[model samples]
Target: MTDTTEPTALLTAIDLTARDARVRKRHRAELRFRGYGIFSIGVAVAALLWLFTSLAVGGAGAVYTTYIKIDVHLDQTVIDPDATGDAAVFAKASYQSLIRSGLRNHFPGVTGRRDQRALNGLVTLAAPYLLRDIVLDDPALIGTKTGIWILASDEADLIARGKGTKRSTKSRNDGQAAWIAELRSQDRVERRFNWQFFTGGDSREPELAGILVAMIGSVLSLLVCFAVAFPVGVLAAVYLQEFARRTWITTLFEVNINNLAAVPSIIFGLLGLYIFLNVLHLPRSAPLVGGLVLALMTLPTIIIASRAALQSVPESIRDGALAVGASRVQAIFHHVVPIALPGMMTGTILGMARALGETAPLLMIGMVAFIVDVPKSILDPATALPVQIFLWADSPERAFVDKTSAAILVLLGFMVLMNAGAVLIRNRFEVRL
Candidate 1:
């Protein structure tokens, strides 16, 4: 009896020791997992901070524009050679000659055609159009001399902005650097808030370029996308979740929607190209077509989100509504849908935000066109903000680097606003019941 009791006690002790070892192993694994999660979060936060800092620093210079105060003589003979006294005539006149004369007078001893041409190169090509607009607006300034702030060339603007390293050799060698320095010393060169950057449209000159057109295009496209996608997606989700029978057809649709959510965005672009552009003969580069393509891409996301939200409502809510003498459609729409609307709106906004930043689809549909005029309607040829950023980033001009960064910041700001709206909507109207 004593021997048997001793062996049993020894076995029980061994079993207890093994159990303790297994428990310690699990605890160590849990600690490792927690550490990995914290490390991953830290890395993600650090990357985000770095990206925002870089964009802010790179784009800071684009908010202000460099200008050279040239005493421009609005010579009637040069600007209105025939003295027609017509604004159209003045608009067509040789304002470039007047600008050249002003530059020559501002800095004497700039003789010879080559040297004169180099001096003229200090101002933007758009400066003449600016002068023409001024003259056309008043026509009284035709023969008077006034100190006008003319836009400097992109290279001169860069140097004035303390980006002298980016100055081209041609701009530097022709005494352009010395001229700019002289202008700065005399306070003729200055930096001011660039209102034109917000108010104008695309230009060959970076100083003259603006995002207004792209902004309008984005707004128009989003409006069209929301108008089409929201109603269709919500209704489809309702039918599928609240009314549709449990059948192979519904199952196939669910699978397709899930698959579409994972499809490459560029595929939507190609599909848009083939259907909207080739078959339907829709206008290329129009916001209407852009919105259509974006709607198609966003539809699946909204449907899935709406269906999930509908599913989340308690079954009791539907039963209570029906017991109160409500029809099937009335119960779902009045009780179930109201409870789910916030989630649907949140999902729709998020999907729209993603659509706003899409470039490949817009590009495939011809939104990459270098559009200088702002679209007055959705049907007009236009470019979206992301497409504009892509075009500017690909440009070889040094000044375009700043423009590209600035545009990217604008795009990011819009995306942030949209996402914030989603969060606000979800929190404000979410039904706890």
Candidate 2:
């Protein structure tokens, strides 16, 4: 063997040099990882921005429509003399036939059945109903003419409202410009504001379809969701975090809540259908039933989030309340809950946003397929906005494509407003401690 001192010195120097090299390598690697992380975040932000811009550009044209003022003349020639003896004389075929003939007179330049129907399609369904009412109410106007500028279809409204060919540009992506040109030749396609989107029902015609029914459905269902989910989820979370004793029993439930949060929403929907519709026999396809299903799916989310919020409250605050002679319940209710509310609201709002966009479970609950008048109550058959969009998106009609995007825009607006309100409430009421 070599001299002991020489071997020891050589080994020690080599070990020191190798250790220094490893330390330097690790430091360089850490910097590279950090740089890559920042770069990935930046790319993700840019991609999201691009996506939002595209959707906004495509969706903004869905809310307004075009219109033309026509001076419609009413006279004895249009209203039958003998029909006046009937209580529902206004519903006579003579009056309808004459009025149809007169409208045909106005667009004399159009002759083909397709062309005339296309122009007539520009006229909204509500327009003729409103006109009929006006004539029936004022019998004195029977010999006179009145001016009317009724709202038109969304495509025509865009043009009449000066939205200028957004669909025309969009169609360029699919080589549909030729068909759009044919529609233009037939005088059926134009950029127009879609007022009906806010006032109409789930029409087979996109121009007649609106968000009103879906809005009502969303409002009623969300009411049900909040009424049922908020109290239950909060209480469950409070019990888990504050009052439950340490045991395998409590631990099992704690794990179960987390697992529930990850379960698929549609599965909850099926459970709701079986329990609420099949067994309980609640009203089928009602907003109440849909809300109940959504509530079940959302409960785990709200409970998990609320529990995190409660955990975030400092232990010192709880101790202080107890030291001041407050009971456990009082301390938790007055101090801990108040402090945790902002975070709780934030979490609950996010979960609600998720719930609002859900359509599958709603589909199972009968919100998937419908084309009826708005319901008078929660028990009425109704469709939520996402489900409405889903139905239209599946339609073969070309116009339904834009209508789907428009409904999505409205749904998106509601979600943004809800989240914004949560932010405002947090800023206004949340305590720093």
Scored by TM-score, the top model is: 1
Pairs that clash in candidate 1: none
Estimate every model's Cα lDDT from 0 to 1: 0.89, 0.75
- Can you give the TM-score per candidate against the true fold? 0.89, 0.78
> Which segments of candidate 1 are over 4 A away from where they belong?
1-39, 80-86, 138-140, 164-167, 170-174
Q: Candidate 2: minimum summed lDDT over ten consecutive residues — where? A: 171-180
lDDT of 2 by residue, 1-433 (tens): 5687898988999999999999999999999999999999999999978867766665665554445454566655556465463336654424434344555666666567766555554456566665667667766666567655555544455444334443444433222223334444656444455566777778765567777888889888988998899889998988899999989999999899889889888899999999999999998878999889988988988888889999999999999999999999999999998898887888788888889999989988888756468878999888898898888889775556667777887898899999998889789988986
| Alpha-carbon runs more than 4 Å astray in model 2 | 1-42, 68-75, 83-88, 91-96, 106-127, 137-140, 145-147, 150-193
Report the lDDT tens digits of candidate 1 across residue range 1-433.
9999999999999999998999999999999999999999999999999998888877876778888999989887787777789877887888888888889888888887877777897889988888888787888887899988888887778877666544466544437878888988888998888888888788888888898899999999999999999999999999999999999999999999999988888899999999999999999999999999999999999999999999999999999999999999999989999999999999999999999999988989998999989999999999999999999998878888888888999999999999999999999999889
Worst 10 residues of 1 by lDDT: 165-174
* Global fold similarity of model 2 (TM-score): 0.78
lDDT of 1: 0.89
